[model samples]
Target chain A: MSALELAAAVFLLAGAGFYLAGTLGLLRFPDALSRLHALTKADNVGLLLVCIGLALLAGSLRQAALLLLVWLLALLAATVSAHVIARRALADGAEVEVRDGGGP
Target chain B: MRLGQRLVRGIVLYFALLLVWIVLDGTGDLVVGGAAAALGAWVGLLVAPSKPVRQRLLGALAFAGYFLVESFRGGIDVAWRAARRDLPIDPHLIRYRVSLPPGPARTLLAGALSLLPGTLTADSDDEGALLTIHAITPDPVNAVRALEARIAAWFILPREGAEQEGPT
Candidate 1:
């Protein structure tokens, strides 16, 4: 395989690994908020890597830009949804393992 | 806002929507696309109203570049922390009061903080001044401050009394 193709494959593998790690975190983390860390962070990274890999393979600037747009939209969606869920959890008084008081 | 300025903003929004349509729907008819973009801008004006912003071009570019780097680092950081067997999380909810005034700038900050690695904005007060964020890092200070600076750079904010972080 060409160097570019190899690089794409590596990226795709890394992306899948992140996705796996995110799922493990979701299953293993204790609380609602902590679980969200995995979903938002790892999953976002996974999507970003996947997009980069696909963009490299697509070999068109326009398609790469489109992939980037998709990832950004996904990031925005994740941010909003995670915030909403966390707000609801806080309102329900879900157990906060620790809380540092208000700081700058 | 002045009527003239509002008209200009609407026109800009219309063109932006037109570009989006053309790019996403390459084969669609031009007439229909134009009407749709116009309708979208009008509806957007109502649903997602925006205030006049004093954004600096170079500063905005810097912010974007900084954001791209930080976002990638954030992803890798979180992935590493989670993948470890130790888990090493000291999760907590903290209240952070941002310097930005309540508006799009504040909202953008909140959204960004949430998307970053260790901090997730959970709630905000009615004023949008105080944010309740879930933080995993021992010290989110430096990172948060850096991000705030980047965002502050993007929108030329007026200086407050003593904490003057003037446009950079």
Candidate 2:
């Protein structure tokens, strides 16, 4: 494979890894809120990397712009939904474990 | 002047929608694209009458840069923690009182915090006075505060007199 193709493959693999890590976080995190963080942040970065890889592979500016647009919309949806879920959990009095010190 | 402002907004929205149509259509068909864009703009105007706030372009660019960097950091931080078998996390909620007004600015702040480092805006009171933010880190107060300042500066909201300092 060409060097560019190799680069794209590497990005795609990294993106998939991030997505796997996000799912692992969702399964392993202690509570709803922490899990929300895992899902939103990790998935966002994962999708972003995937989009970039795909855009590079596509090699068309218009398609790249559209891919970026899709990423933006997904980011928006993820942010809004995650906030809503977290808010509901908090309203339900989801227990939170607070630690002392190490805060400025 | 208000009519003129609305007219200008309508034209801008028309062109923006038309660009989207062209991108989606991918055929350079101006006639259909123009009609669709016009319809879309009219529907947009009818549904959302209020004009968006004037954005400072430089400030927005700066905010975007900061957001991108912070989001990257946030993703790596979470991934690192998730990778650890020990699961080092000290989750807590803090009722953070922000200074931004109760409309778009406040909403933007909440959205920004959720995607930032180890912090998520779980809930805010009815009056938007206190935000119940969940943080994986021990101290998210300073980070939240810094984000608040960044947003305030980005939107060019007045810092004095309108400040509503609530309990932390």
Candidate 3:
């Protein structure tokens, strides 16, 4: 495989790792509040990295640029939408129940 | 302030936005584009009939900052819930009565509530005096109570009429 191909693979793998980390965080975190922090931050970063990797692998400047634009737009929309929804949830009054074992 | 100052501020903000857009798009020719955008915005603002709402800059900024942080927190919470195999969810519909009257304040409250984890705006009736919410985690009473408390803090008003009831 070419150097570009190798770089693409690495980026993709790194992104997959991030996604896995987010999933584990979701499962392992004891409380709702803490878990939220782990999933949102990790998954967002993971998806971004994966998109960048795929864009690089496209092997054409025009195609890569288009992919990058799409990625950027998607990220912006996701971020804004996430923020809006979370604010709404807070307004709706959700709470993190205290664990019996006193661990977050 | 004179009309000219308002015009200048609007022009500046518009031009700045256009420039940012150009950089992101990589169109490479910004002078003409920037001028066009600024002119368009200027004309639109001049023709717009509605008066701008008066907001205390500090208060608005604080509210925005708080909303940004809370939304981030909420997004993570939702993602976690979505990934779980055993959905530890207690879905229920709740109606919350709020203190803010039916204007931007109430709309803002409703909009903000729609973002948090496990809660969706089933309906917002009577200009946001009442909000029907579907929550994944249930506990309608407490959810409404907490939501009201947070909103009250953000909007700087005590939610006097806030109450919640579980769906039938």
Candidate 4:
């Protein structure tokens, strides 16, 4: 593959790795709020990186702009949904239980 | 601002959405795009009228820079903690008070804080005066404060006495 394609592949792989990390945090984190942090922050960066990679591969201005728009929409959705979930979780006292470092 | 000005804002929104629709659906669908844009602008006006803030273009550019760097850091931070065996985390919540008025500014702020480093914002108390933020670390207060200040710079906020009187 060409060097540009190679760079795109690197970004795509890194994005996937970040997505995995975010999912790991979602599964292992104790409470809803912490999970929200993982989902909103890590996953957002993951999507952003992936979009960049795909835009590079597409190599068309229209497609790249569309990818960017998709990422922006995802960011908006994630931010709003995370806030909703976090707010509800807090109201339900879901965060009342906190165990530092997975203590027994 | 009067109702007439809000109508003007709606017209601007209509054109903005029309351009977006044209980009998405192409020039062949002008009629559909125009009709949808008009409807969208109407709905937007009813749902949320534009609140005028003294926008700082330079501050917005600075904010964009800050957002990119912090979000990149945030992802790496999460990836590191999740990958480690120790799972080093000290999760807790704090009520971070904000000076921005109770409206779109605060909503946007809450949306932004959730994407920042180790912080997730929730509307728990104080009716937009305070944010209930959850952080994996013991103290994200300083980071949150810095972010808040950055975001605050984007707008010339209404003074204490002028807040009650809607957008001027």
Candidate 5:
């Protein structure tokens, strides 16, 4: 594979790593709140990295610009979405049993 | 009103957008790119809603920050669930009122909801300001609260006014 392709692959892999981390968090966390937290961080970072990498590999200006635009829009959407889900979980009566009344 | 103020804002937003474009595109010609951005912005203004963009802009940024943190946490949770080899999810339907109320603010909230994982807007009523969200996991209360906080923060809407008890 070409050098650019290699870089793109690395970026994509790293993005996948974030997804893996998210999945791991989802599976391991004891409650919904914790799981929601994991989902937001891993997926958001993963997507951003993957998009940037893809943009780098993209051959045309228009295509790359479109990609960036899409990435930004996705970022905006995801950020709001995570909050909504988390709030919903809380609203649904998910108890926070393990807190020391402070940071973790 | 003044040329300079409008020019400066336009230039700043243009640059922000252009940088994204350049990164996505392998090459850039300053002249052609500048012309294209100018044309694009002009078109953007025409097509954009008549309402002011400032509120929406601020709301969008706040939403972005909120999403990043939540999705990260969500990813970890998903990972853990997979490792356990059990799908312990208690999916259910949740109906809640949207606070931002009918306009750009409301639209932003609706659009953002679709992107979040494990939750879907099952139904919406334009006049009632109600949204029925389907959540994949057990907890629905927190999900609605999170929605409330995020919408309030982004749109600067008052929670007391926008808040309504969830439909049971």
Candidate 6:
């Protein structure tokens, strides 16, 4: 494969890894709020990486810019939805595990 | 907002929608594109009938740079924690009294903070006075306060009297 193609493949793999990590976080986190954190952060970054990889393979500037717009929209949606879910969890008075110090 | 300013904002939004339509539709058909863009802009204006927030271009660029770097850091940090055998999360919720006034700026700050490292904005009070955030780190209060300062700086707001202590 060409260098560009190889780079795209690497990015795609990294993006998939992030998405997997996000899912793992969702399953592992103790509460709804923490799960939201894991999902939003991982998915946003994953989408960003995927967008970059696809943009590199895109035929034209317009297509690349459109891919970026998609990433932006996804980021906005994730942020809004995460906030909404967290708010609902808070309102429900979900039990959250509180640890005092920074993790090792 | 002034009528003229609103009109200008609407026009700008209309053109932006047109550009998005062209990019997505991938067509050079002017008639359909123009009609759709106009309709979309009209709907947007109805939904959010206000002048866009004024942003300093340089400040916005700086904020974007900071945000991109920090978000990546945050993603890696969480990924590492998820991958470990023993989860190292010290999850806690802390209330922060927001210093920014009630407006788009405060909303922007809240949204941005949610994406930053080790912090997730859980809820805010009805009056928008206190924000309850979930953090995986020990010093969530300090982390959020630092981010708040960056956001305030990004919006070009003066930070003299707005600084306040975190809720205990």
For TM-score, the strongest prediction is 1
Q: What is the DockQ of each candidate?
A: 0.55, 0.49, 0.08, 0.40, 0.14, 0.44
Per-residue error (Å), model 5, residue B19? 3.0
| Runs with alpha carbons beyond 4 Å of true place in candidate 2 | A97-104, B28-32, B47-52, B158-162, B166-168
Write the residue-wise lDDT of candidate 3 on A2-104 in tens digits.
8888888998987787677667766765544434444555565567668778987875665666666665566455444544454466567756332111011
**What TM-score would candidate 1 get against the native?**
0.89
On lDDT, the leading prediction is: 2
User: For candidate 4, what is the DockQ-based docking class?
Assistant: acceptable
Question: Per-residue alpha-carbon lDDT of model 4 for B20-135, expressed as tens digits?
Answer: 78657777989889999999998988877356556688989998899999999999998888878898877886766565676666777788888988888866455566677778
| lDDT tens digits by residue: candidate 2, B56-111 | 77888888899888888888888888889998877887777676766667888888
Give the DockQ of candidate 5. 0.14
The per-residue C-alpha lDDT of model 1 at residue A32 equals 93
In angstroms, the error of model 1 at B105 is 0.7
Candidate 3, superposed: residue stretches over 4 Å from native: A1-104, B1-9, B43-49, B56-61, B101-107, B126-129, B139-168
Give residue B160's error in model 3 in angstroms. Answer: 14
True contacts kept of 6: 0.47
| Displacement of the residue B28 alpha carbon in candidate 3, Å | 2.4
Write down the lDDT of every candidate, Cα atoms only: 0.79, 0.80, 0.57, 0.80, 0.60, 0.79
> How do the residues B4-71 of candidate 6 rate in per-residue lDDT, one tens digit apiece?
87677779989998888888877778789999989988887777735455668887788889889988
Residues B35-75 of candidate 5 have per-residue lDDT tens digits of 77787766765565544334456766877788766554455
Better of 3 and 5 by DockQ: 5
Predictions ranked by lDDT, top down?
A: 2, 4, 1, 6, 5, 3
Chain B structural similarity as TM-score, candidate 6: 0.83
Model 6, residue B86: distance off in Å is: 1.4
lDDT of 4 by residue, A30-104 (tens): 878888888888999999999989988985676787788888899999999998988888779784533231111
TM-score of each: 0.89, 0.89, 0.50, 0.87, 0.57, 0.87
True contacts kept of each: 0.62, 0.50, 0.00, 0.53, 0.19, 0.47
- CAPRI grade of model 6: acceptable
Q: What is the TM-score of chain B alone in each candidate?
A: 0.87, 0.83, 0.60, 0.84, 0.69, 0.83
Q: Which CAPRI category fits model 3?
A: incorrect
Report the number of the highest-DockQ candidate.
1
lDDT of 4 at B23: 59
Which CAPRI category fits model 2?
acceptable
